[model samples]
Target: MKPQSMLFTIYGEYVRHYGGEIWVGSLTRLMGEFGLSEQAVRAAISRMLKQGWLVSRKVGNRGYYAMSPRGQKRLDEAAARIYRQDSQVWNGTWCMVSYNIPEERRQLRDQLRKELSWMGFGMLSTSTWISPNDLADRVREITVTYEITDYVEIFNCQHLGWSHPGDLVEKCWNIDEMNQAYQEFIEIYRPQYEDILQKIQNGQEIPDNYCFVEKTKLVHEYRKFLFIDPDFPKELLPDVWLAADADQLFQDYYTLLNPCANRFFDSVYEPCPLVEANEVNS
Candidate 1:
């Protein structure tokens, strides 16, 4: 993971619990586990501050940073997608966005396409994108941001028994590719998991630094799915959906590693009023 993205990972996963703030000294120390230099970490912080994702506060001689309102909103929206357990009810409907941008505005068109994909909309055609979840708010945000509301249209739609959900899944996404990614995640993390299990079985203790690094890397790797997969409902997926298995493994190992990881975080900074290690089971 890039050192800059690691800033968000640390804040969203850990520091947010401690009043959504962190000191530069503490951040530099935590980032060392990933082999990031103190200078590099500070540079990333500077960039984040300039980008308006972070705000600084002074306490005596030291400065502490926290997410700006804009940054918090971005993280909150991402959390909704990343940590969501698939909804229990899909309602047999789809949300679609179709745009017909002028050829001369190719840059705007490309940007719109990227934003729609990030919002979990799968490309149904060159100009049409669809998702099982309601994306009205996200679509509105993109249209307003790009000033292209007039060129785009959003629809709430249903299949009407004409096309198969499974076939649509295949057409809109590369299930084979995603399954391979899931398999790779299993291969990489499963060994780390077995080592943890072996330590437990032998009544051996795990090092805090090891736990911290392993958990962070695992999260960074698994989060790649958010960009690659639309995470469609089960009814719209192939019978052997590996994402479910991957998610199960993530939850199981994440919980197993939590105490050690939390122990590491607690050691890096001063005690806080809030919980140091929030449980990830939810």
Candidate 2:
């Protein structure tokens, strides 16, 4: 992973629990497991600060990094989707966005499209996007951000005449490819799952360093889904969805690894209020 991406992955998985702050030494040491040099890690941190995703503070002679309020808000929004367990209760309604931008505003148009996709809207045509979830507020935010409220329209409607909802899903998303990716993830991480389970059953504790390294790796692997999968509702997904299985596996492994990983973090950084490991299962 790129150092910046790895940095965010680390924050989302571990650092957020510590009030979204960590000493530079601890951050660099943790990132070292990913084969990133301390210099590279520092550079990445600098970039993040410049991008307003992180803020730096000095205490005595030690330097620490904290997520900016903007960064914290983004992470909080992502957590809702990443950790959501129950299937969405789809109301059989679809939200659509249609836009026509002038050539002079093509850059803003591109930005709008990207933001829409991140909000789980899939393109149905060159100028149209759709989602199962209500996206009025999200669309309002996007339009306000891009100053394109006059160029776009949002609608909530149900499919009636031509193509089936299933067909529309297939056209908008590459479910087959996503399924294969989930299968690949299972192949790669299934052994780690079994090994961790065996160790737990034997009443053996994972070493602090190894636990830290593996936990980072686990989060890195799973976080890729945030970009690649829009995480559509189960009712919209195929009959044999591998993503569901993958999510369950992630939950089980993450729950088991939490205690050991926290031990390693406490060694490197000053501990704050602890979030109970069992909270994940809840």
Give the winner by lDDT. 1
Q: List candidate 2 stretches off by more than 4 Å.
A: 271-282
Q: What is the lDDT of residue 267 in candidate 1?
A: 88
- Cα deviation in Å at residue 240, candidate 2? 1.8
Per-residue accuracy of model 2 over 1-282 as CA lDDT, tens digit each: 799988887788778987788878888888886689999999999999998899876655567788888788767767777887686678888999999999999999998988887777778999998888887787887698679999999899898858777788888877788898999989888889899899889998778778777777877887777666777876788887898889888888888787888888778875333445542210
lDDT by residue (66-122, candidate 1, tens digit) is 898878876787777668776666788899899999998889999898878777788
- lDDT (Cα atoms) of all candidates against the true structure: 0.82, 0.81
Stretches of candidate 1 above 4 Å error? 102-108, 160-162, 270-282
Pick the TM-score winner.
2
Clashing pairs in 2: none
